[model samples]
Target: MKLATLRRWFSPQTTMQGKIFFAFGLITFLSIVSVTGIVYVNMRDTIKHNAVTSVSDSIRQADESLNIMLEEIDRLNTVVVTSKNTVIDTIMSPNEEISYEWFQEQKRITEFLSVLINYKPYISRVAVVGLNGKVFFTGGPWMDRTVLGTPMLNYMLQNGSRHAYFKPEGAADAITVGREIRYNRETVGIVMVDLDYEFIKKTYGVKPTADSLLYVLDEQNGYVYQSESAPSSFAPSLEKVVEIKRKLAGQGDVMEQKINGRSYIVVSRLSEYTGWSTLALIPLDSLLSESTRIRNLMAEVAIIVFIIILIGSHQVSSRTTLNIRRLRSMMMQVKDGNLSFPKTEIKTKDEIGQLYRVFVSMVDELKRLMEGIRNSEKKKREAELTALQAQIRPHFLYNSLNTIKYLAKLNGVPNIEEVSGSLIELMRGLLGNSNEFLTLQEELDYVFSYVSIVKYKYMEPIQVHTQIEDESLLGCKVLKLMLQPLVENAIMHGIGPSENGGQVLIRVYAEDQDVLIEVIDNGKGMEQEQMDALLGSLDREDAASRFSSMGIRNAHERIVRMFGEPYGLSLHSEPGLYTKVEIRFPKIHHAETSAQEVV
Candidate 1:
């Protein structure tokens, strides 16, 4: 039912008021819809861009804090490895001595470690473990003595480095950074410091977030550490972790992706000191919650505005077209044979007032115009009779030509009879009918008669060659008298004035989807400039050019009028050579020629 109403409203029979309402209402509605779409797309992009930028800034701050903590760890190593205390060197010296000095060295080493614990509270333990399985320690000797690996000590000794970092084999949340104490160019013992994972997590200083997560990736081995505020529901899968790892390896610091049916923007910052990356993931939908509310509100406002516009447009159109409706009623009265009516009085200076004034003026002239038309029509008939009287001259000439042809036959003069008969045929062809399209064979017969007349008049020894490659195309239709002008031009301009009269050749053939006709003349071939001027005259449609080349121009115009511009004349010539004129038309078969003649 709605579709039927819509069809009627837009149909041609619909009232003018309905058309006005639909046109203005549709324009207003489409404008609002377009603006709404643009705002929605831009809002989405802006929200995503701001969210990514905020997350990236937070990650950068966390990475800075983590780097500071890492720097402190390195400082602790520097303090122990570069110290000038001789007691530490004596304890790590390569010598076997069971004496009082050895116990004194152990006491001195324990005091030194105690000082490091007081300096950095986050360090869980500080100890020195010797090759003989004895440990001088502080901070409660938290780690097992056997947990210290000897390979780290051997690496420091071979590379001549004092400190190295390592993660304990089974410990998940702690790392050990140790420095070797050397004496006389040989490593005697190693000093160790353990940093707990909780202290490292506290370094980032991330706050709680409802829809965001924070995690750290170890650059050395790709390990992950999550903050206390990190949501469990927002945990990344193994695949996502791999992808983040790949991102960290490159230069990209911000990324947006869909994970587990939710869009998230991930921002990362790499720490140069700790060789770890800090990542924050923010949910895009949660970030754009306010934008969604605004969009809903906009839609509601737009619907209300459209309703108001629809009601207002109807009232305005109805009021504006009231004068038009009254004018229509007056016209209906006139149609019902009422000779007079009350005058319309619209006082406002608008289009309706102008329409009233114009109608009053037009009604006053209607009776006078009717009387004048009656008198003019009577004169038109008399003029047509006068034209008929003038047409008798051509009929008299035709009769005279017939009589001459009969006399020539009676006198045994075949050439004069042939010429006279050709002239009679030419006259009949010109005056036959206005809507005549002749077949190819019929046109050729007319051209042959014209050629015979020209040959007899000029008495020139010019050879004419005609070739038809396709016999079926002989019945193809063409414009009547289109070929006769071309033959006349060839004889009058190319052959008649020439010292040695040349040949004219005509060829017709079907090629691909078109039929091509050519007329070639060898006598007095035109130069480039002359050929260009002649071709230009044929192409022009103005009166001056048409009058100058009347015969050729008329033939070209008739062919184009029948078959369109693509099927027209083209000429080619060279100095001292032959001139060729080509004509193209759609190839129509004899059986279907009548139905396709309009082409």
Candidate 2:
């Protein structure tokens, strides 16, 4: 029982309330989860990136300052070697001897070097050594000749007037720059500039926190410098250094490394002044501490939002289902045939409101359809009753005419007997039930009887001319009483009303897919308005009251009803001339066997 209840609750066929609640809740939950996941990932990356950027920028500025100092030292050397005084040239010239001119040039060049050393505080000393065994110096704390004779100095001289950075074996934290001197396209001597390399440590020491470490590595040489507080072994391994060099060769500027099982962010920059790399390593734990706190807060806020969404979705779904349930209940009442129930009304202009309005309209239409059906059934019964009543009149006339025939025969009244005989035959034709259809020959015979009676009743003589175009068409079937009424109407309205009596013409022929019968009379015909009114009334539902002879309208309606509108009566007339009534029917022939048997 519990399983069945659960199935019903979760089924797709369940109430709209459950579906709406489940849909909205699931969507909200999924949306919140997706947004939270994306934001969490981006925030972590952005935090780490900002930390890396700060460290890289610090190292970059230090590198730029170091490069500028190196360039300045080179510039100062260039000034000494290319000096206008030519102090070294005067002293080492094999072309000239040491004289007053040479001494004055030396004094002037020494004073120029002194001025350069004063302006650049980073430069510890500047010296010029001549290959001819002569040397000039500026500043104190001089070094041995061996320090100047390092292989780097020889390399600079071999490469011609270019500068090279050198670290003397005995100097603790100093870098020397040496350049070759040339006079008149000949290597005369060497110019050397000693810069205080400890300045690099001072420049970066004040920037980083005490915990951060900084180091510089030379590609061809080992580590040149490290912060005083940093341990010598704290540097990355030889393999890591080699990897850093390889990575720095490309566009990669930063790499993440795990040193001694601790994560670190390593940023490296290649110096343009020296073919070396400066690398800065920062602990990942410290960098991500604030990011962790933010993530936790975000998780808490997401949970609160999820709960709020559930409550809001439940409320909205409940309201929506309430309106739908009310509408469903009303529809159920309508389905049970209780249309008299109160109409559904919803003031909300939503789709549900439109559905309710459509439901009401459908119910109203159904009610009207039901009422129309009931009325139609009642009318059908009334029409059948009227047909029965009409049938009695012809039967009574047949009986009365028979009685008159008997009286006229007994009294030897030939005219009265003959008239009553024809009247009786005509009455029988109208009363007989032949399925409302008669053969052409049978209909013409009935017409003869009607004309005989009409002739006896009137004093004027009337002629009827009948021309059958096809003899075989005499066997064609048509509506019964179709011709007799037309003949009677011609006599009463068309012929009898004429001062000079007119003859009636009847024609039966076949045209196209139809058989046509025409009744024409030469008499005082109707006016155009009268003819129009008369012909127009033939097609109307209440055409019975529009004519003196109900027979004409009834006959017209019977032909139309039997064979459809195309096979009905049409009138053409002109005043004081002639009037023609044409009748049309489908060309249905009586069976050959039936006609032969009758013959």
Best by lDDT: 2
What is the per-residue lDDT of model 1 for residues 1-599, given as tens digits with 9 covering 90 to 100?
A: 98986687689888777787898799889988998889887988877787777666666776676556556866876777667574356554554446677777767777887888787767877767665556667775364456456554554444436445565443556666777766677666677777776776666555323667676766444454665555567677656866865765685887776777778777777766666667777777677778979899989999999999999878766766897887777777767866467766766566876777777677667756777899889989999998898688779988999999999999999999999998888777777545456788877888888888888656556677889998988887777777777877777766667777678888999878788889888866666656566667666555223123545577767667766867778878765667787888776545335534533
At residue 383, candidate 2 shows an lDDT of 97
In model 2, where do residues sit more than 4 Å from their true spots? Answer: 1-39, 90-106, 144-148, 205-211, 237-240, 247-251, 294-599
Candidate 1 at 478: error in angstroms? 1.2
TM-score for each prediction?
Answer: 0.39, 0.41
Clashes of each: 0, 0
Q: Assess the local accuracy of residue 589 in candidate 1 as a C-alpha lDDT between 0 and 100.
A: 48
Which residue pairs does candidate 2 place in steric collision? none
Model 2, range 342-452, lDDT digits (tens) per residue? Answer: 765776677888888888889889999999999999999999999999888887878888899999999999988988898777667776754556788888988888777
The RMSD of every model to the true structure, in order and in angstroms, is 18.2, 25.1
Local error of candidate 2 at 30, Å? 11
Query: What is the number of residue pairs that collide in model 1?
Result: 0
